[model samples]
Target chain A: MTIEQGSYESPIDRSVFDQFAARLAGDLPRPTVVETMTALLRQEIIDGAYGPGTRLPEESLSKRFRISRHSLREAMRLLVHERLLVHETHRGVRVRTVDVHDLGEIFAARRVVECAAVERASDDGAALAVVRAAVREGQQAAEAGVWATVGTADLHFHQAITALAGSSHLDELMRRLLAELRLALHVLADPRRFHEPYLERNDEIATLLERGDRTAAASALRTCLDDAERQLTAAVAA
Target chain B: MTIEQGSYESPIDRSVFDQFAARLAGDLPRPTVVETMTALLRQEIIDGAYGPGTRLPEESLSKRFRISRHSLREAMRLLVHERLLVHETHRGVRVRTVDVHDLGEIFAARRVVECAAVERASDDGAALAVVRAAVREGQQAAEAGVWATVGTADLHFHQAITALAGSSHLDELMRRLLAELRLALHVLADPRRFHEPYLERNDEIATLLERGDRTAAASALRTCLDDAERQLTAAVAA
Candidate 1:
């Protein structure tokens, strides 16, 4: 069932794999083994075990995860639907290869959805507190020099901003968008370069929103997204 | 495999099914028969062949659709993923029963995503024309006294407004939202009561957008969504 020889690369870095293991180790007892496999495999993708465009043969993955082929197929099916992986009819699945064009469109969507969220949000002290907490977390992660964790915290800031609109559906939508955004981030030559500059901008947004200057916060978010889009586009294009 | 006896119902009214049949009949030569079956079954849900909260027993449905159990499972799996159906552990599947609390959250989300879309949309004559076209279609459907179709057209109108943001991700998100909305619509005893007043409101918003009054259009959309939410909430409360 191992369809290819070169695509599947087991993670050799114990330190990095340990982080993923610790984070996902506490997922309440999964209903099915497929659920567990999906979580682990997705974390592997995020941890960069398998690089972009690598084939994820179901036969190999089921063996690696110690699950049945049926369970593996279910996990792959969900990932494919999430656009994290692409399923080819005759060739099987691979990590999605997001081009610069897709990244550009995704950022444009982020601008539309996220900006609207901040702009329309009411001046709730409690909501602003949550967003500020996410920004502070991002800064602390950056101070600790954990760039990968900082990106996670940065995504949390954006998610918190979306939450201000008081829509669970939009929150779900932003979660999906951010996952896709991460895949796009994985394409960069240096993922750290992609997230480092945005920490300060996130702080600015949190501060603006706290001051009830939502219009200014939204404008800042738009520019921040534009700058990130330009940076990613240049990286991918290069 | 015949696990249930009374859960399957073959839709007798081909006229209603025909509308769904035609709309979905040209799904571009499905790669697998499961894809075709999924589309048709989804349409049946939309057409109310299987009412909300009714058990969709796998064994019975496989027989009704004249497909293998494997293919039926595949289709049901996709629908469950879309939130159109709920799969209970050991109880098989049923059309999702959306609660009033969920309806409030979903409508609130619609206001955030859709109002932001209209408010920020470019005053493009061509884009506005497409929106106008959807409004015209809704009016025509209303004039012909087809409130169900009018509801469909109104969904299209809101979709068009989201499209004005020109972000495909938002469009995909809205598509998901609208599907959930249709599920909510299914809970209504009189669908006409939900859609009739919105037709005029749709026209007004379209006119506002055409005149470059994006603020007015957005305000109108917010009110429209609020009114619909109130209507649905009252209906569900009753």
Candidate 2:
């Protein structure tokens, strides 16, 4: 049966689970099944293959993914906890819907964490080269009009800057925050309007860091964030 | 059957589902069973009621909490998402263990977010009074020698300050970071060491904010965080 028909008709099939398990053979290193499932779901969400508000039919997901009903449900629970998905009784799970307030929160958090990271990066042990490389990649992606690629690169550029703060906990927090923020970007109308200018500003911040001008680098990073926040607010509002 | 015995012998029972449904009757608002279970599990972890690295027997939790195996499993999935718990297929679930580096990362995040918040709280429109009230509560708790109470009050004081930054998102991020930090506190040898000094420092920062001295308040808050970080690091290292 086709995936959709199977989902509606029976929600479960023994062969689907068998295929899912078979598909997993040799595909991933011997990680736990839940981790493998999580990675797959994350990629699907990030790719916009699962549109916001559409229910992720558990049976279909299990059948197609070839994992047990138990493991797929567990993976869905993780996504829900991450705020990437929301689970409703009877209705099942759907990708979370992002609104204007969510955009503001995501960027506000980015400002607090990322700017501090940039300030920290200006010292001797900072990761200047990583930021520069990310910026270069962002510039290339922007020129190619691959807005999603450019957006990911821009996020990486900022993430690398934050990593200079030398706190893995902060890095992990920022990483989760960035993932949520990227979801909003998927629905944004003009992605280029948000990313193109950031490439040059990222370069400028890196240069300031290389010059050991922590204050200037931090100030520039703040301006960069404020500008992006304003643009995102306008885009999401529109 | 007694709770402990039932947990071991026939751990999955029909009444398990009934008890959860009854407790969630009309009064509490966020009505999802899985979410309620998640909150219960999170509280148990934070309170250190569940010993670290102890495998949470699913059947036992399901019976004791009087929740369906499916619902309990879903809640376990959320905790795993929060990194408060980890799940291994053959081994089942265990409370997550935080190391010295993890503790440092948690505090570093708090420092960045809280300092920014303090600066904002000193602004004209910010809610300084609310923060002052929470600080007073922390001081009172400390004076009473209620160290655990003081720890909780201290979290409230900082959360109130972060809320004054006028961003719900930042407040949520701060709350999560604080919860993770609390887990680290569970491992620390002397909880009183940090909370005792923090009560006084909270008052100092509050006074600075009341005077509308944003810079000084931010500076003082940073010092407070630095001191706490040092204590936590020392405890973890020891």
TM-scores of the candidates in the order shown: 0.88, 0.84
lDDT of 1 at B191: 67
Cα error, residue A65 of model 2, in Å, equals: 2.9
Worst 10 residues of 1 chain B by lDDT: B1-10
Report the Cα lDDT for candidate 2.
Answer: 0.75
Instruction: Name the best candidate (by DockQ).
Output: 1
Query: What's the i-RMS for candidate 1 in angstroms?
Result: 1.5
Clashing pairs for model 2 are A20-A66, B16-B66
What is the DockQ (computed on Cα atoms) for candidate 2?
0.58
Best-performing candidate as measured by lDDT: 1
Q: Write the per-residue lDDT of candidate 1 for residues A1-238, one digit (tens) a residue.
A: 1112257845334354345445656754325455556776776666666767889877666655556777677777777877788887668888876787889788878887788889889878888889999998988988899888888898899999988988888888888788877876665666577788888889988888888898999999999888988887887676
Worst 10 residues of 2 chain B by lDDT: B1-10
Tell me how much of the true interface, by contacts, candidate 2 captures. Answer: 0.78
Candidate 2: which stretches are off by over 4 Å?
A1-29, A122-126, A142-145, A188-190, B1-30, B122-126, B187-194
Clashing pairs in 1: none
lDDT of 2 by residue, B134-228 (tens): 88888888778888998999888889878877766678778887887787677655668767877778888888888788789889888888887
Best by TM-score: 1
Q: Any runs in candidate 1 off by more than 4 Å, and if so which?
A: A1-6, A9-30, B1-6, B9-30
